[model samples]
Each structure stands twice: as structure tokens, then as C-alpha cells.
Target: LQLNVFCQTKPTIEASTNIQFSCIQIHYDGLDKQMTAARLNLLNNYWDVVHDFSADESPVANYTLLYEEKAVQLQSAAVFQNSSVTFERSKSTVLSTGNLLSENINQVAILFCQVDNESIVDDPKEPLLMILDIYRQLNVSFVKTVQTPVDAATMRNFVNPRWKGSSKSKAVMAIFIWNCTDNEQNFFNKAISSNNWVGKVNLKVGSDAMDVIDEVYKIIDSNRS
Candidate 1:
């Protein structure tokens, strides 16, 4: 048994790279380079070497590692040092959003889906309103309205593909404004269960917009795999 490479060409020749193993063949266009994280993922490796285990201090939960002398008293932004106000106002959130939107269109993006007004709950108007406020404030490229729940197949058409050979490209993420309706919930659950999409996305449901965003951010932070 031996690793196989069916074709080889100069690096400047950006054509497809072909690989075969006797009965099996895989075709990959060599136009762009794969990112380090994705390359590791294909090798069945973890994104964070410190993780790959079930622990409370998983990559996302644990603070980013920094090296300094106890000289590493472990200093973070004062805001992050406190528990009550850690997320009350986060510079990281603002910075990440700005960077994502400002980058090339081929890269990162946010898909926002607004649930039908009629489907909205009469209660929890405050939380809904907050979400609306953030929506309005965002430098939106596009807003899609879903009158009813949709299957994952329908969403595939709009979602930009993420995992390509291009090192520069990234996954398309989405913010779904849920009305806490059973039908919508069921639709998403079914779609997730099917899981046939090419580009991967982490869809999390929460009571408020903030909660879901927080959860999504965690996934995004650790999604190097």
C-alpha cells in the first residue's frame, strides 16, 4: 500500500491536482492554497493543540495563551477581568464585526433572516426590540425575510461555499432571528440532522439574539478545525 499522486505540475500552473489510490480517485483544483487550520482538519487533527478533549477549559472557554514573566500575572482588558460586565460591552465583538464586513466580498459575510412579523411573540417585546436595534445598526449587505420555516436545502442556494482550496476564503455565517415558534425550530432541527451541505455552519438557538450570537461566536472562535 502506498500514497498516490496521479499528477504533478509546476507551482505556477494553477490547475487541478489529481490523487488516486488504485480503485479510488479524488480530484482537487489547485488554483488556491488551503488554510493551515483546514489542512490540519483534513489530517484529522484538532484546531487547538491544547484542546481535542472534553474539558471545561476547552480552547474557546480558556483565555488565549500569552507568554510573559508571572511577569504573566495574566493581564487582560480590565473589562474582561470582571465577571458581571465581561460581555456587557465587548471590544472584540465590535472589532470582529468590523473586520468581517470590511474584508473582500469573497471572504466572510453574515446572512440575516427575519421571521415573519405575524409569527413574532407578543411577549418578550424588549428582547426582540434589542435584536432589531442591532440589525438596524449593522452595515447590512443584504437582509432575507422568511415568511415560513425553510429546509437546509433551500438555504444552500444563498449561503456562499466556505471550504475551497483558496487559503483566503472563509465560511458564510448566518444570524437567524427566531420567533421561538415550534415550526421554525423543527425546521432548523430537521435541516441540521440532514447535514448534507458542503460548507459547514454552526447554528445555535437561544432565547435572545445576544445569547445565540454569543454561542455562535464561541463556535466561530474555535472553528479553526
Candidate 2:
């Protein structure tokens, strides 16, 4: 003969919000006796056992089983210190709504922006000034700048082939400015050729300059990849 066992639960308070699990046990008497019943009896009190059974010289018996409820819930806090802010062309400003000021949390602030030579050609120094303005407005101590090159060599080496056709000249000039620095060796190393002299500007400010540059490089590399 075949025996089947099943278990279920009655509805409880809706606030319980916990998951419930159940199981059932069946006992066969044809090939078992008191010795088997003793072992089964020992297991009856286990927390995991919803139900258990024993047969008194009978061929079969069935029992329903159940288990304690278990549940999982997710919770989070809306603290700005744990969040990040980003700036893109589509947005008018780098500041995110309600995130401009800090109450008591000290944070590592970063600023990143891209500018083309054509956009600031009238005043070649405007790009740097714009960056400075943003730094002052945000009270940020660090700033990192990335220059995209337009020259054929730079285009072939760094700039994507797709962008080369549209603004090849601008990309090369931007790269030239980006690589320039007050140090003669650093400036020479980045120059297009030994004969083509490029001017360098001392833009490094405070101890945070290096950190800002490193962060900006990471963002640029990530975008390129």
C-alpha cells in the first residue's frame, strides 16, 4: 500500500510578515517495530519537526509537519555622505539637488570638466578660469583637467578614429595644452616634435592637485574603455 503525508498552515496576523515552512512524516509498520519507534520518538521534539508519528502494531501511519517562520526584509538610509554626485553636459550644474552642503560629514570632493579650444579661443585662458570658478563656487579643494587631442598623430594614437574626421585640429591642440607643464622636461616629453615648441602653464594648486588629477584620469580612462 502507498501512504501520502502533507502539511499546511492557518492564516495568522497579517503583521507577522514572516515566511513559514512545513513538512510531513509517514511511518510504515511492515518492516519496523518498537526499536524504530524509539528513534522516531526522539526526533519528535526537534524544533524542525512540524509533526511525527508512530504505529501501534499497525501496518501504516501518517503525520502532518510544520516549522517556525523565517523572513527577509531590506532597509536603507538616505544619507548623502554615502552617495555620489556626477556632472554631464546635459545638466546645467555639477551640484545635485539638496547635496551641495554638508552638515558635519567631511568628504573628499572632486571636480571634472571638458573644454575645447574653439569654445574658449577668444580668451585662451578662459577654460582654466572656468574651472577655477567652479572650484570656488563649490568650495572644492581639488580639480582635475583632461585634454582631448586633435592632431593626426594624437588622433591616431589617443582620439578615436570616429571623432578624428569631425574635429581633428581641435583635438590635437587640446592634447598639447593638457600635456604642458612648467617643468621643461615634462613639457619637452609631451611636445609633438623637438622643433614645435609648446607653452606650459603652472596650474598645480595646493597638495590636493595630484589627487584631483589622479581621480580625473580614472574617470577619463573609464570612459575611453
Candidate 3:
């Protein structure tokens, strides 16, 4: 007596799991019903993939064979206050939540907190790459405050050196600390609105870090093309 077995195509994507097996009848003719009945033996027995299921044993199999599989979804975010400081977001602030080495990220935001011109030159590369995120993925950077907004020529020169990667590639947003009393902060607002901002980038000004971050979330969560 011979038994025929067949298997169907299995999933290959990293997300797929679980395989189902079914019993298929092949012999329906005058193959003696008693003979088929005898094939059914003990209810439980040791089973092996290769012997029982005739599964593919080749090393270079096309489908993924999971011995033990587990799935867990993880949320991640990186934030930097300054070169050395890192501010934690409040749970109320973050609905969910890296040098974020992926500068080719979909969006980029340059944040202007209070700053003196001295540290701008020596700012670590890590902080520039790292950023705060509770919603969508984007890059955030900090810049030195100037007393007055930069002109078109200055905007081209001033924004690039501090910004890594292609300036025009990713969507850029500039967020500055805007207070009527602070001259530098006032200028920071105007700097972001230069021709550089119009259609290519987003500009937001707020009184404090939390306020700026809140606007950041709005921009990131928005669906404006």
C-alpha cells in the first residue's frame, strides 16, 4: 500500500506565521475500504517533519521554516535637549513613542532653543542625528540664535553646514523659540520664514520647548502632502 501526500505554498514574508495541515483523500476507487481503514492506527505517536510530513529538508529552502516564533511590536523614540542634556517627554505629551542615523528620513525639523554661538561650531554629530518623536518619524536639529534673520544668500549658507545630508531631499521644518522680548528668538522666527520656507519647508515659532514640540507633533501628524 502507498500513501500520497501534498503540501501547499507557504508564506515567506517576515510577518507571516503559522501553518495548517489538512487530510486529503486520494484513493476512492475499489481500493478495498478495509485496507484504507487499517491505515488508521494509534491516535498519538512521535512525528517528525521529514518522515511524517515529508517536509523539505534542503538548507536553501524558499520558504521560512520557524522552529519557534514569537511576535512583539515595539515603539521607539530618541530625544536630545542639547549636546549633553536629554529631556523626557511626559506620557500626556506622548500618545505612544536614535542618532536616528537615517537622515534620509521623510522629514527634518531644525529646533532653535536658547543657544549661544560658541557651542554651534563644536556641537556633537550625535545630537544632530538624534531627535524627539512621539508620533511619526522625523529628524530634529538645533541651531545657534542670531540677532537678525538671514537673507536669501545667508539662508543658503547658514542652514546647510549645520544640516547634514541633502537639504532639498527631505521635507524640512524650522521651529524656533519665539518670544517678543528675545531679539535672537524673534530673529530666529524670521530666519525660518525666508524664501527657504515658502513651499519646500515648514515654519513654526513657540514660546517654549514644550510648545514647539507640540507644534512639531501637529506637523508630523498632519497629512499635508
If scored against the real structure, what TM-score would every candidate get? 0.20, 0.20, 0.17
Please write out the lDDT profile of model 2 over residues 1-225, one tens digit for every residue. Answer: 111112111222222222243322222232123423333221111222222223333343343222211111223334423543211222212211112123322242322222244543222244434443433333332212334322344233332233333333431111111212246333333331332222322222223433443443454456456
The TM-score that candidate 2 achieves is: 0.20
Off by over 4 Å in 1: 1-169, 193-195, 206-225
C-alpha-based local distance difference test score of model 2: 0.29
State the displacement of the C-alpha of residue 143, model 2, in Å, after optimal TM-score superposition: 3.8
Compute the lDDT of residue 185 as modeled in candidate 3: 37
Model 1 CA lDDT for position 157? 30
Local distance difference test scores for all models: 0.28, 0.29, 0.27
Q: Per-residue lDDT of 1-225 in model 3, one digit per residue for the tens?
A: 111112221112232223322222222233223332544211111111222232343334323222221111124323322333222222111111111112332232344321223332233112222222211122222221111212233233433334322322222232322222355434434543532332333233332333434443454335222
Residue pairs in steric clash, candidate 1? 69-72
Candidate number with the higher TM-score (1 or 3): 1
Q: Pick the candidate with the highest lDDT.
A: 2
Candidate 1, residue 107: the lDDT equals 23
